[model samples]
Target: METVSGHRPTIIDVAKRAGVSKSTAARALAGASNISDSAREQVLRAADALGYTRNALAVGMRSGRSGMLGLVLPDIANPFWGEVARGAQDRAADADTSILIFSSNRCARKELMHLSTLMRARVDGAIINSVADSLDDLDRFGLPCILIGSSAERFPDTCSVGSDIVQGVGLGMDYLRSMGHERPALIVGQPTRLARARFLRVVHEHCVEHDIDPAVLLIENADYTVEGGRFAMQRLLARNHGLLCVFAANDLMALGAMSAVREAGLRCPEDVSILGFDGIQAGAFAWPGLTTIEKPARQIGAQAVAWLLDGNADAKPGTRVHLPCRLIERGSLANLCDASARRVGSVKG
Candidate 1:
């Protein structure tokens, strides 16, 4: 057949070459069972000869599926979020779908704006790791969503996948206690009420279990940024210079806190032990590798996409999937008794 304007061959060209109707050619190319095998074979042969390619946009328009997923993160700059994004991207690729990621900068207003944009784009579904107080607004979007991390509990109507924060905190606190640190402080992330509250409750309960005075527990809030961690650590030092250890909510903050310790002429694991949550890769390269609770951030991200695309359709509202975290020992943490003995020996000399 003569080409029209010498442009790439279209499905229409394939239809004509195969001696079949346009609908039959389209259905055959799509592998629809209703089309006879003979017709399907003819369409396939014609498509190969004409070099005809299917248009994803046209397919989406006809099927009512955009084949796109949305990922909303509080802060993409953080390595933890990067790991999560990688996981989501890998999973989306496996499903032959695309992912569009948006960062909210941990702001409620910006998060709403991103969600609105995604809705206008008609994404098939979304996975949000939001710091916003309420997820009730999400219902208005009418899109399937899966909450990541603590936000999952805040919105019971959506499916969620995350590490068990309570268990993670407990594991960290218990490890510190075993190492001989009694007066350990906590440096938490931005003021997300539920997450902050859960971490504090776990810290307090851990203190009580160890017979450590709850009143002596020092708690400070940072923006979950490196600088925020540095400032929070400085403030903690200013208020209580005798603290033997500190636990940060995430790794970036932990690294910052360690920097603050060095600025104050103190050494990690020797002068003041440090522990962190979220086992981001950067932690392994820190001055004294961070001792942290390793959350399966990548796994969580991948699972969120799976739930949104394959599972959420049949899952009951408010379904939560909690993954476990493990403790990673590194140079940053030291046994309290060992630290004390060294200090006493130096004083005597």
Candidate 2:
């Protein structure tokens, strides 16, 4: 074999130099399951001599198993999904696999196109956290898929992993009630899917049980942004029900609500307590800090990949794995009833 130093060679170059069929060369390069040791060694030696690296793109086109798991998410700018991606990558590495990512930014069309791309790439599996209305668009793809932060009701045969959002939201309200905040408002994002709807429903149920007027504290449905949070909070505050606190569906809105509180001449925890969902890092740095339910973003990512590796994606569409959440207390919450202060006074005495 004539060798050109410092120049890359193709798979055909490796096959010719290795004295093996192109198919044999391809399988060895792809690290397929059933290749004989002798052929693999020859392919490796020839590949090295020819300065060849496997063209994963070409290999993916020819073979159904690209050894890649594609992760499709809505709004990559959100820190929560970033943690999810990190967890997915870690789990994929543990399984000797790689990941591909596409962000839809909450657009249904973009999400559909990205899924199509993943299919064309021949990815072995996919982990999708779509903002689409339902799994109807997804059902047509016919690929091994796991939906994250989405339900499996329509497609009862696909694997899914998500937070126990109902329980998580309920836990947040329970904390507020315990803290002596009688009139609490909800700042929820526009309901795009089941997850958001369940969160709103759970919060409402808790409000009703506690003798709180559900009408006075209904969620301020708006965009899930800092500005949207501020707007929703402004409207909630105008009602003048002596609302002592507000619970945002996620941390971004929580931060926004905090901003609105300050802008409206109220000190957080003094005039109004604030609570956010999603244990995002930003919550810790916000002025006065934030009390929130810690969403298992990273764990969701890890668990999704684990489920895929465990062959759960192939079982049925509606299979779901709901992970739990915990509460994080911080300066943003102050007991309007002075219960926390009284306890501290008793300790000092």
Candidate 3:
């Protein structure tokens, strides 16, 4: 990546190219305020031609507030987290804030370290979807924070915005149960508060009340990754005979489970009905267009900001807020007595 002069183009060169002062170029490139539109366009074009990237660290330090928010998510590649990031960024921009993003990949120690780094930066605020398994692990954030997909009960003073896991799983169970899926398989999330463990508890309770076996096969925990979900589904299919439906904790795992079903020579909703949580865009585009629970991610993100900035003097330190999860029926489910079921029955006969 060499320039024609065999030297990297500097900020001065950008200013000269754009016919603007050094200060003006610097401000425009850093997204500073009060710069004329025409001048800003010139600087942007000049920077583009020079292939310039701003030194955010230096700029961030100069501005005490960083005008930035730190977002810590379990996995950036996951669509659900991607939506969270989208919502966070959209709202932060509205508030004239920037975002510094990081992915924990569901490691507790890594998440804590990231929080510490954000605190050190004196970030205006942090939006975290942490996988901390205990209160001690979550207590590390000594800054204004909003926890997405985590409970307010765990962190008293912190603001939380999460989809109702209990209700989401219950929606899936209710649909499956109504479809006559008496022997459904379950893919539990990794035993963290928001992702896996709570949903499992809700479904387990539903099973017991309905007089279904509380201990069914293919029930296991994994990181909320596609590969993890696929592996879990494979293990479940091998161990669970006569299973009619599979409920995944998240959309990624649900899509992975669909792959596993296809690999087992089964078709969705016909041979086996699969349901998932997190009504992300990718799920709607899935081959069978996954049936799932819709989480109001953008709404949650915006409202979380409202809560944190509410400036309520009497607001309790830790107030838990749970958003409702709405069931979305789609192409991935069918009654056990449907044509696919009859096909399986004929094969067995």
Query: What TM-score goes with each of the models?
Result: 0.87, 0.84, 0.74
Provide the lowest-lDDT 10-residue window in model 3: 340-349
lDDT of 1 by residue, 1-349 (tens): 3366787888889999999999999999887999999999999999998878788667877787778889999889999999999999999999988999999987889998989998877788889987677767776887788889777776776778999988899999888878777667889966645777888888888888878888977888997778989999888878754545889988989999999988988788677788999999999999899999999999998998888788573466778888999999988987756644543111010
- Stretches of candidate 3 off by over 4 Å are 1-64, 133-141, 151-153, 191-194, 216-218, 311-315, 337-349
Per-candidate local distance difference test: 0.84, 0.80, 0.75
1-349 in candidate 2: lDDT tens per residue? 3456545677778998999998899889777878999999999999887778676766667665677888998888889999999999998998888998889988889999999998887788889876667677876887778888744444556678888887898888888888876556778877655656777778778878887767776568867778888898888777665545788888988898889888887778777778998899999999888889998999999998888777788865567778899999989987755644522110000
**Superposed model 2: Cα runs more than 4 Å off:** 1-7, 11-51, 151-157, 191-193, 211-213, 337-349
TM-score of 3: 0.74
Candidates 2 and 3 compared: the better one by lDDT is 2
State which candidate, 1 or 3, has the greater TM-score. 1
Model 3, range 1-349, lDDT digits (tens) per residue?
3467887777888899999999999989877888999999999998998897665566777765566678888788878777777877787778776778899987878888888888887776677775676656555555567777754445666667787777777877888877777656777766644545577778779988888878863576766767777888788767646645778888888888888878877778667778888898888888899999888777776666665555321264556678888988888877765545443221010
**Cα displacement (Å) at residue 113, model 3:** 3.2
The top-ranked prediction according to TM-score is 1
Error of 2 at 253 (Å): 0.5
Q: What is the C-alpha RMSD of each candidate to the true structure, in Å?
A: 3.6, 4.8, 5.6
- Find the candidate with the highest lDDT and give its number: 1
Instruction: Supply the global lDDT for candidate 2.
Output: 0.80
